[model samples]
Target: MIAGRMALGILVALEVAAGCRRGPAPAEPVKVIVTKNGWEPWKIPARKGEKLVLLVTRTTDETCATELVIPEAGVNVPLPLGKEVRIELTPERTGPLRFSCAMKMFQGVIEVR
Candidate 1:
C-alpha cells in the first residue's frame, strides 16, 4: 500500500509539471488608429529591437497616401482612400522617429526605448 501511494503521488506531480510546460506564452499586439488630423494616439512606445506592426487607415480623402513617410527607415507608403494599410517597423535604436503624411499636414511619432 505504501509503494502504491508513492507511485500515485509521482504521477500527479508529473502531470502538473507537464501541464505547465504546455501553456502558451503571453504576447499582446499593439494597435493604433489613423485619422484625418494624424495618427490617433500618435505617440507610441516600443522596446528597442522589438517588432511592431502599425495599421494605418485613411479616415479622409484629403491626404494623399503617397505622402506618408518615415524618414528614419526611408519608408514611404501611400494610403489608399477608405482603406486600411499595415506597416511593420523594428526599432534599431532608442529614440523618436517621425512619420508624416505627404503634404506634411498629418504627423506623429514612434518612440523606441
Candidate 2:
C-alpha cells in the first residue's frame, strides 16, 4: 500500500511539473481603442525583444482615421470602420515607436523599456 501511494504521489508531481510553463510565457495581446482622438492607451509599455500584439478597434467613423501608420516599424494598416485589426511586432530596442493616422494628424506611441 505504501509503494502504491508513493507511485501515485510521484505521478501527481509529474503532472504538476508538466503543467508548469517553460521559457518565455506567451504575452497577451493589448487592446487599443481608436476614436476621433486617436489610440486610447497610446503609450504602450513592453519589454525589449518581446513580441507585442496590438488589437485596434475603431469606434468612430470621424475623419480619415480608418488607417494606421507606424513609420518606424514600417507598418501601415488599414482599420475598417467599427472593426478590429491586429498588429504584431517584436521590438528589438528600447524607445518610443510612433503610430499615427494616414494623414498624420493623430498619433500615439509604443513605449519599450
**Highest-scoring model, TM-score:** 2
Can you give the lDDT of residue 6 in candidate 2? 43
Flag regions of model 2 displaced more than 4 Å: 1-23
Clashes of 1: 3
Local distance difference test values of all predictions, in order: 0.60, 0.73
Error of 1 at 43 (Å): 0.8
TM-score of candidate 1 relative to the true fold: 0.66
Cα-based lDDT at residue 19, candidate 2: 37
TM-score (all chains, Cα) for each model: 0.66, 0.76
Q: Assess the local accuracy of residue 98 in candidate 2 as a C-alpha lDDT between 0 and 100.
A: 75
**Candidate 1 regions off by >4 Å?**
1-29, 64-66
Candidate 2 residue pairs in backbone clash: none
